[model samples]
Target: MYRQILVHPEDRNLQRILWRTSGDEPVKEFQLNTVTYGLSCAPYLAIQTLHQLASDEEDQFPKGAAVIRRDTYVDDILTGADTLEEARDIREQLTHLCAAAQWIEQR
Candidate 1:
């Protein structure tokens, strides 16, 4: 999720990822190049991504950011409306908001 947020080029080296497929293989070292899961700061990084996207005025929806900040948890987005049309509209709005941030809605 941290990969979702853009990081400064200067700071990218700080997020270097070093690993190997197997013990017999030589250790490989490379920069993350993007935020990723499991880093100690990943949750904060993901929240930053959400905050940055939600704060954009051009893509703001009625109570949309509030809903995301308050309702979202562990990748689940929980929302509904009194009517199907309203629900669908919210869905579309949310989808557009994510798309604007380069996150394609999967499903």
Candidate 2:
């Protein structure tokens, strides 16, 4: 889920990693292009991204947007509806909402 949110280009430098294959090798720098799991800001960034997405697509997915804003926890969503029909509708809305951001939800 974190990997689905891209880091801003200017901020990618802050997520850089240095690695070496062997003791004799020079260190190589790699810039992370997405929100990584272990970074101190990862949780905030991911949740904020979801909020932004909900805001952006609210008109098209009000139910899903509400779920994102109210029920999302880190990478998980815990929500329920009063009726089976409403639950299905919410699921559809959430599926479409996530698809809008290219974030696939695995059942």
Candidate 3:
């Protein structure tokens, strides 16, 4: 889930990785293009991104936006509806909302 959110170009520098395969190898620098797990700000950034997406697309996905803002926790979403039809509608809206954010849902 964190991997789905991209780190801004300007902030990517802060998420850099320095690695070496062996002791004789020189360390190489790699900048992360996506949000990484275990980072101090990862949870906040991921959740905030969801909220921002919800706010930005509220008109087109009101139920999804509400779920994002109120039912989402970290990388998980715990929500439900009174009826199967409503549940399906929410699922569809959320699917489209995620698509808009380029977040591919993993089954």
**Structure candidate 2, residue pairs in collision:** none
For candidate 2, write residues 1-107 as lDDT tens digits.
Answer: 98888777898988889999999999999999988898788899888988998998899999999999999997799999999999999999999998888643232
Model 1 stretches astray by more than 4 angstroms: 19-28, 58-60, 103-107
User: How would you encode candidate 3's per-residue C-alpha lDDT over 43-94 as one tens digit per residue?
Assistant: 9998999998899889999999999999999879999999999999999999
Per-residue lDDT over 47-84 for candidate 1, one digit per residue giving the tens place of the 0 to 100 score: 76676667773346755666667777645689878999
Model 2, residue 37: distance off in Å is: 0.9
Error of 2 at 41 (Å): 1.2
User: Highest lDDT among the candidates is held by which one?
Assistant: 2
Poorest 10 consecutive residues by lDDT, candidate 2? 98-107
What is the Cα-based lDDT of residue 54 in candidate 1? 70
Stretches of candidate 2 off by over 4 Å are 103-107
* Each model's lDDT: 0.70, 0.89, 0.89
Instruction: State which candidate, 1 or 3, has the greater TM-score.
Output: 3
